[model samples]
Target: MIGMGNPRGIAGRPLRVLFLVENAPVPGDRRVWNEALTLAQVGFQVSIVCPKWGYPGFYEERQGIRIYRVPLPSLGGIAGHLVEYLIATPVLFLYTALIFLRDGFDVIHAANPPDFLFTIGRVFKWLGKKFVFDQHDVVPEACASRWSGIRMRLTYAIASWTEHASYRTADIVIVPNESVRRLAVERGGIDPARAFVVRNAIGLAHFRDAQPRAELRRGRRHLVFYAGVIGPDDGLDQLMLAARHIVAKRGRQDIHFAVLGDGDCAPQVKQMSQRLGLGDVVEFTGWVKDDRLIADYLATADVCVVPDPKTPVNDLCSMNKMVEYMAMGKPVVAFDLKEAQETGGGAALYVTADGHAGPEAFGDGILELLSSPGMRESMGRIGRQRFNEFLAWEHQQASLLRAYQTLLGYPSVLVA
Candidate 1:
């Protein structure tokens, strides 16, 4: 007989989950980390299997959750992603099976960019497990945004087919925003009610007491900050161009730009920044993992910019960085994206993308925000207040619990 709160438990026992993510490791991917920890805190036995990225493969325990990191080869370009996915898929399946036996799971919560986990989820489902497809982004659109070639046509077709398959197979579909929920219902052909919208929000504990670091400001009159991935479609080049337009053409040397986070494009963006005469004014802190330090950078900054311009993937995706900047009580400037517009509320200034929303307009928006201290303060206050009231992790936690309860067939969720 299984014990109470045991993963393989008898009736009235607590629930258990196996979370699979391929894009990044747990704890590093804040959303995944928060979800795992939140579930664990609420009495679920949570086990996560993810890639090592470069770290040595090891099993560790953090915040009462078990994590198994599998090593993956570092590669670039389309072929590289494909190879990494191919290798990681089997590793994830193998490790997940081992975890299930060691610490049994009632449900499999899988995150995607590969969208290939549905096959494994299907097998588990055949064995009487429930599946949840956590949609972080639309794979086909994200692929098209990053690469354009005849070789990718087949890849895109396969991704589209797999995306629909993932949706069709899931017991419940979880999305970041309304747009993604609509995509799953309308295009992916899932039932509307079965798809849940749990928007990306900042877990307040991650930045609770973060204070400003004056050195980050670099004795500048205004500081501009950019967080999140530095991928091709992220438009950091556009930001570098804007920085050039500000420092070189506009002759505004008082503004300092801090580019945070990392991706394959960081090297190119750094090179471009140096070539464009932004060497002295622009600082690239590639992928800072310290939440406190990142929060400090956010607190010290005058304004934050979401340089991801209009794109197929970006149009629907809800960016975590945008919400995070707001959570830290910082104002934002971003391209006039529908989801960003909705997420940022009145906290952000929209730069019109007449044609891809060039750097000129972006520079102007930053300059305008920098010039008016009162407007910046007002936006920041509105953002922080709005976050506390609605956009904070608290609201998201309620939605998440409701979704889980509905999916698990519980009458109601019991808070712990």
Candidate 2:
């Protein structure tokens, strides 16, 4: 059964949707790319506005979606970040206004701000277009993670106010998790009824075609995989600390750990690994462009890990890696959090929140899964089954479309 707001009237016709994303090159981000593709599939004339970076310069209409990549300077650090955002906002505003003037759109969907897309939403509203808030990160929680000065506090205050405006201006706020939806209702002053929870889901079709070629493991005794950003929030050092414990204390030299993906903290993470004398056991493949390697990395592992430290952002957030690992039929071990626990369920071996759940705890978690192949198989089966039944991308599209439809006061379906 479809949930409360199924779109019964809006089928077959190509509905126009303009998606706005920040700091990301189009066709690069999995979540945004998935959203764009899905909307295109369901007869939507989709156009995306994003920054042009890396080799894929400027514009390309990929998979029936129009992309407009505006030129922006890449800057780093707090001051650099401020400049980048400051520059991006006006550029986004100018280009978006042009798009609205040129293409008659049915909807204007923008991803979270600095969650301040309300300014853009206001522009689209003036053009008689609907607005959708695709909430990916909680700006307030992220503020705590990234900044710590009075200036930071002041910036956060402005961001928070803008977040409120975005929520108030939009017809519906689409969140990654229920916790985020509640936060929008509670803090952002959005109506609970209008808030839509669209989970970060894995596209199982990609994994189905992706053959797990385990060359990275290269005849290793046991493979432990960690994929995603190499950032402070990722707790990669914790994973390293656990790897150190496994090698020195547990005397396990047979295991190999592969850390995939890149981020701002790569240099520091690499330094930490070297200092821990984990040079031999640990391997960091920074920012992979190959998709087959990604599948193999997850599929080849005896156990996959999500080592996000316990924080408000983490607790409210659902990591896509967990579901992807499950889709590849791999058991997972993660630090305890409500969303992680709920998503992984009995499919994961959770480390206790007490002090024991450190590097040693992480090591023990891996060892436990390694020791019991049957348990590993059982958890993997549960996870894969869960993904097939509930957490797949197809299951999530209804919520996504419903959020958009609701903003347009159009009917929508909840995926059953």
Candidate 3:
């Protein structure tokens, strides 16, 4: 079967899930929305609580799931982030209190980048609610990647302590990759059996019957596509530098770069591109939310690039972009990191991870793949096959179901 919907019933009654996320809005956050749908399909009365990242409304219902949104504060430096989380905590707690007062949840599924939510889980756990810590990012490493010196050390400690608390509070730890699962067990001292690896995968249905938009190529010999947050760890600087190397240094005026998505570094990246004299050679479409635009970008590009320079957080973390690229039957050029290599397989052209050399190699890789349409097509075919076989969200959902089954202690007869 290409896909599996969550079964209609569990042990006796419909399972109730309270999903919580600190970052990103519902529906916009594809992973959370997909998980909510998967759980809802299985007869779980799903309710999501998330920060409204400038989205209108404090509450709404979409596709049979109840979504509650809270105000998201403007992002700033380290202190600003702290203020944001501190502010969000009370709002979430108040919202959660209301939910429990009206209709309590059976399972509290909390996704983390900010890991202190375990305290709320612990509080709910006292009232017999099961806590599931969905480890989205290793906060310690994420902090380390974002900063350095004493500030880095302090952030690492805070992240480490909170992550440990989260793990200790969790009845089951849901991780996106084996590396993360291993981290939970080894570093967080979580029980190995209690940790589950639910990979980040594309919802295959979204790409079904999707057609190429040749117009997105924009009169260029080759279109290089990149989409996602342009943070420090994201290596947008490296990407811009590589584009400069290709266009200005190597004199490849025929190729055009379409850098989609945005983050804190977006303005700087745009400025850098201009300073590099990549005039008219690069396009920065900041934070594209339009599905058709994103689809067109993915469709028309000859190759997609995963420009995350190798870091502790990035190395272990599986990229949504790489998987999305493959799902779209597009080949990739990425830094050779463990999980990235594991995720893309033969679908990506990897550059050795040696800082400056990596971007140079990445540029070369784009050129190399662009030169051969047959190779690009072949790699895309390989990627799409691999995605269908093992990497699609449909396949990944089985593990999610099984994880819930285990956490709920449902009998074999209750397994979907």
| Model 3, position 389: C-alpha lDDT score | 91
**Stretches > 4 Å off in candidate 2:** 1-13, 73-77, 147-152, 209-214, 353-357, 412-416
Worst ten in a row by lDDT for model 3: 1-10
lDDT of each: 0.84, 0.80, 0.85
lDDT of predicted model 2: 0.80
The reply for model 1, stretches above 4 Å from the true place, is: 1-13, 54-57, 149-152, 413-416
Candidate 2, residue 293: Cα displacement in angstroms equals 2.1
Q: TM-scores of the models, in the given order?
A: 0.94, 0.90, 0.94
| Model 2, residue pairs in steric clash | 3-414, 5-412, 6-411, 6-412, 6-413, 7-411, 7-412, 7-413
Give lDDT tens digits, candidate 1, residues 1-416.
11112233468566888999888888788778777766776678898888787455578888788888888665567888789788878888898788778777889999987798998899899889999999998989877877678856867897899998999889999899999999999998888878888888876565878888878878887789999888877899899988888887789989899988888888999999889878889998887877889889888999999989888888887889988999988989999888999898899999986664478899989999998899999999988887888777767876676667667765452434
Question: What would the per-residue lDDT of candidate 2 be over residues 1-416, giving only the tens digit for each residue?
Answer: 33333222345456688988876667766788888887776557899998886536667788889899988776656687678888888888888878777875678888874555578788768767788888888877766666688866976787778777888888888888888888989998888879988888867687655655556665677999988877657889889988999999999988899988877688898999999999988999887767777876777789999988777678888888898888888999998978899888878998865564576897899998999999999999999999988888878977776766666565554344
Comparing 2 and 3 by TM-score, which wins?
3
Candidate 3 residue lDDT tens string, 1-416: 11223433446556688998997788887888888998887668999999888678988999999999888675656898799888887778888889888766888999986897888898899998899999988989988998999989988999999999999999999999999999999998998888998898767777655557766766777899998888768988888888987886778888888888877788888899889887588888777777777887788888899989988899998898888899889999999889999998999899887866777788888999999899999999989998989889888887887777778765333333
- Which pairs of residues collide in model 3? none
**Prediction-by-prediction clash tally:** 1, 8, 0
